[model samples]
Target: MDTTYTGDVTPGGAPDVRELPHLRITKLAVDPQMSNNCYLLTCRSTGESVLVDAADDAAALLRLCDAALEGVVTTHQHWDHHRGLAEVVAATGATTYAGAPDADAISEQTGIAVDVRLQHGDRIVVGDQSLEVLAIAGHTPGSVALLYADPDGHAHLFTGDSLFPGGVGNTFGDEQAFATLVHEVETKVFDRLPDDTWFYPGHGNDGRLGDERPHLAEWRERGW
Candidate 1:
């Protein structure tokens, strides 16, 4: 990967294709391309935006902004999913937000100091847009998924590495903390989110709630 990388689609089955009103979601593929999914959410009314997972090229992320950069929300502290935190904030003066428990790690990367530290069930506001930060740990101690609504009231899940399109993220990387990822996904991430909300994984394509609903049983079998 170079300093200024371009975005693309993740591999595997066809990627999630959503057509939301007043909001556009672009799957900006980045390094370690398989499971790193980055997103851009732009408000139609204000031309302001919030970016999810600035783990890619800061320049590329900015180019994709196309609107004023309001903030960067990290789903977890993984380097591949968060390497651009400093560049993004420096470029836009945007605040840094993450699972409140991740404040230390986020602060270390951001250096502007963390403006907001959120826990599960907390929501951060950017313009009229409010993104509900759900603590979905396991893949990491502080992985979070931002659940927000589209204009028509449809919900979108920007799930980190906890869940994915066809399969779920591998928990072996966590060593002793593997259970955290599984429990967080089955209980925290999937428990509250409607079975109908669209699930976008950190490193893969999107899977609608309806489409991947059955996989929940399999995910639970692993004992979260």
Candidate 2:
């Protein structure tokens, strides 16, 4: 199924999985129409893959799973990010997971109940890889991020919409929400995680913790 990513490619446009050798980080850029980033993390040892954010184009996402899909984790319940949730869940029958607080909210929106309600510090296993859940509420009350470290100690973070490259996600004009997001990003993402950690956002280009480190104060002072 060519799960391995090829060349020096940047993620955008048509969906394709970019496989990383150090750790099998499959960046599945799904739903070109929406340009949503759906990631598939595959364990080379067991071939079991976990799909992050089944955003759009269910058929394309299902094809990327290639029948080895173990589960689907919805980063947040935002409509744009979960358009294909019900379809993918119905087809694959893979257990759907979401933050505990947002489970019912997401289910109400998508019509598919969350099988697992993840909380901060919970662990989700994809074959040999273990993803640690970090609830970074801001963009949505239940917005979350998943952190996984490969054998080489490199960490990968799947940040739904809380943390981004230039600044924190939009707060819809709510100052408190923006503050919550920045605090969470500082404490959980920036303060705890290392510089080299690669983060895949909900949309657009991916970024490293190091890339956004210098601008933390600026983001906070400006307040998204």
Candidate 3:
């Protein structure tokens, strides 16, 4: 299995694929305007897969699957995150999952009902593997991060827009929102996971927990 993927991608370009012992992760950038990152996680053993954030470009996303897709998980209710959700779900008949608080908004936006409303500590099974849901509110009332604890190695986190390389997601200058996002990220993520944990964000590149650990205080102080 290859673990050297850089997670770099561009809209309308090919996806960056990473092969783990039990899972295969493909990161694709969609929506030129939003530059949203969509991830497909496949269980090697069972051939079952789950797509995180349909984002946009239904044709491209469907091609990425290449076969059956078990489910789609939207991290938040942001419009850019689910632009292609309805189309993808219609074609693949995949179950839709999203954080409870944002489920209604996502359903309203996409015209597709969320099959499962996830909460913190919930487990989403994809074939033989499962992802733990870590609800990190602030970016949105229901923003969630999916954590896959690789039995063979360290954990992999699909953080959506709640956490990123430099700092937490945009809180729109709301001090309360910023505080909530940063606090949850530190407590639920940094304090709980090891430094080696690799994180995949909703947009742009991926990062390691260890690489961003030292700057947590700085991020908080800056109040972004």
TM-score of each: 0.81, 0.91, 0.98
TM-score (C-alpha, index-matched) for candidate 3: 0.98
Best-fitting candidate, scored by lDDT? 3
Candidate 3 on 96-186: residue-level lDDT in tens? 9999999999999989999999999999998999999999999999999999999999899999999889999999989999999999999
Off by over 4 Å in 3: none
Model 1: clashing residue pairs? 35-203, 36-203, 37-202, 100-118, 138-180, 138-181, 139-181, 182-224, 183-224
> Cα RMSD (Å) per model?
5.7, 3.0, 0.8
How many residue pairs clash in all the candidates, one count each?
Answer: 9, 2, 0
Name the regions of candidate 2 deviating beyond 4 angstroms. 1-23
Model 2 whole-model lDDT (C-alpha atoms): 0.82
Residue 167, candidate 2: Cα error in Å is: 0.9
What would you estimate as the lDDT of candidate 1?
A: 0.69
Per-residue accuracy of model 1 over 32-71 as CA lDDT, tens digit each: 4434667877765776778888886777777777548788
Against the correct fold, how does model 2 do in TM-score?
0.91
